[model samples]
Target: MEVAFSGINIYSKKPEAVFEFYKKLGFRVLEEVAPDDKWYGSTLALQDGDNAPIIWIWRQSDEDNSVVCNHFVFSTNGKMDEVYESIVAAGIACKPPFTAVWGGRELILHDPEGNELLFL
Candidate 1:
């Protein structure tokens, strides 16, 4: 058997803000479902001119089924520091870059909805 990771789904109360946050990180919208419609969500990917999406952000509602996590980590192509600086400059509260015990330089921050994210 063989498997490959495609993308992750994120549930957020502020889906638009989350989408904008990812956009600032250089991710482009692969697809987006307007909030006025039944399924409100968006798929995003690194803007390397590829069609592969890396993350999906779904609008959460009182009736929606979803899972919440304290944090998640994303691997970077050695631009972690630059990304971290950019995010901080944007006025978002982000921890300074530091070496992770798991063996990589990492920076931590929270999304508009308070979901912690670690960039490695």
Candidate 2:
């Protein structure tokens, strides 16, 4: 079978905050759902025209059935340092960048919902 990776679904008690986090990281909102509706969420991408991965933020609620992965790694394309600086400047608590034993530079941080996000 031929397949292509496209996106990830993130669940959070405060989806808006998660969306805002991505926005601060340079992801633009492609579509958004009303908070008062059944679900609150936003589809985001680095650039509208690029084939880059998409991020789907969905609100966590008792009525919803979802499986969540609390950790995710994203490629910064050698911009890990810049991203680390921006995240810190935004007042987000994150560990300083470090070189991995495997020889990759990485930065670790948690989103509003406490999901670990590692940038490499």
Candidate 3:
């Protein structure tokens, strides 16, 4: 047997809103999956062109089919505070920014679809 994780998919009622949310945090939309994808929304990818694995997100209803999807973590060079600023500018409600035990700044916020983004 062979196993390799491809990406993460998050169901959202407002995937585009979630898209814009992540785009501010540095993710690019690779393409939409369906033609009338407005119902199922889209699939987004974060690609830097260096063999970096891409993350995928989908827009779908969670009324029935549901599973586990944790918050995504992002690593920054040195703009943790800049992230805080962006959140504030976006007027996005985020958990209070704080330092972690490993001496990293961390922040948590939920997308319109209810997925969490843990920025560190």
Candidate 4:
């Protein structure tokens, strides 16, 4: 089968809170699956300008899960600064969104899960 980039596995300690964070970035939860239904995790299906999902939050295990997958990048249509300011204003500790070595500006946030989300 032809393959394309699907989504990230964001394992959260407290997924409900993390879900709110993504909601600020405009990711709407299309469908939510319970832990028992899918092994201690929730598949938060979200959309961002495309029908396909670009990010996912799978809350499993305990708080010790740190920095899942180095980092995950989310498209923001070049509004990095705005997104950064918004997150900062909300009291979420994060570095100012800036141009990355990958050639796109992104806002880096370390969620309570200790996992980093790069808002590009």
Candidate 5:
């Protein structure tokens, strides 16, 4: 068997707001599809860089069915500082970048819907 990570599904109560937050983080919207009778919710697929994993933001169809996790880590490609600055300029609150116990640098912030996003 073979497998590869392609994307993540983020269910949001206010998906439009979530999408704007991601856009500020440099995610370019590749496509958007609205929910139909056969689908659950509307969705927007986004990517930050060439070959980067796509992020799918979905409007919640069932309030109780939304999913949450500890966090999601995004690679900064050696531009952690620049990313941090951009986040701050966008008025997004974030913890200052710091070295992890594993010796990698990271900055942490939360999305509009309160999902933790870590940049490394």
Candidate 6:
């Protein structure tokens, strides 16, 4: 059950501003989704790194305002289900695992303070 820190998802009322700021700081756009898409956002990776994306800037959606959870995500090394089950068995509350718009299996857990942690 290997895991690696993936990235942070930032909800922004001004996604373009956030994008521009990161761009000026040497982050390259890895992918972008239009507003009409299921997930309107951009994935950004550092210019000099071969690692996976480190930042996700998501446009705030009016219809699903509750969907945006400022979360730190982690890759489960293809063991998302196993890890999810383990967490649940330990009596932690978690949302059912689901497939994310980016096509990765994901599970979200809430901390005591109600902050979310996403596992993919």
lDDT of 3: 0.67
Q: What is the lDDT of residue 96 in candidate 3?
A: 73
Where model 4 places Cα greater than 4 Å from the true spot, the runs are 33-41, 45-51, 62-67, 89-91, 98-106
Tens-digit lDDT string for candidate 6 (1-120): 988868777766557766665555356788877755555698888634665657887776656556444555566789987877777665565678998899878887654324466777
State each model's CA lDDT, in order. Answer: 0.77, 0.81, 0.67, 0.65, 0.74, 0.68
Total backbone collisions for each predicted model = 0, 0, 0, 0, 0, 0
> Please, what are the lDDT tens digits per residue for candidate 2 over residues 1-120?
987768888887778889888777777788998977657878998756667778898888977666565787878898878888888887777889999999988898877777788888
Q: Looking at model 1, which ten-residue stretch has the lowest summed lDDT?
A: 46-55
Clashing pairs in 6: none
Could you arrange the candidates by TM-score from highest to lowest?
2, 5, 1, 3, 4, 6
Which candidate has the highest TM-score of all? 2
Model 5 lowest lDDT segment of ten: 35-44
* Per-residue lDDT over 17-41 for candidate 1, one digit per residue giving the tens place of the 0 to 100 score: 8888877766777888886755578
Q: lDDT value for candidate 4? A: 0.65
Q: Model 2: which ten-residue window has the lowest total lDDT?
A: 62-71
Better of 2 and 4 by TM-score: 2
What's the C-alpha lDDT at position 78 in model 1? 95
lDDT of model number 2:
0.81
**RMSDs, each prediction?**
2.9, 2.3, 3.4, 4.2, 3.5, 13.0
Q: What digit string (tens of lDDT, one per residue) describes model 5 on residues 1-120?
A: 786677778877677778778877766667666544323333334455555677777667663665686488778899999988988898777878999999999898888878888888
Q: Which candidate's lDDT is highest?
A: 2
Total colliding residue pairs, candidate 5:
0
The ten-residue window of minimal lDDT in model 4 covers 35-44
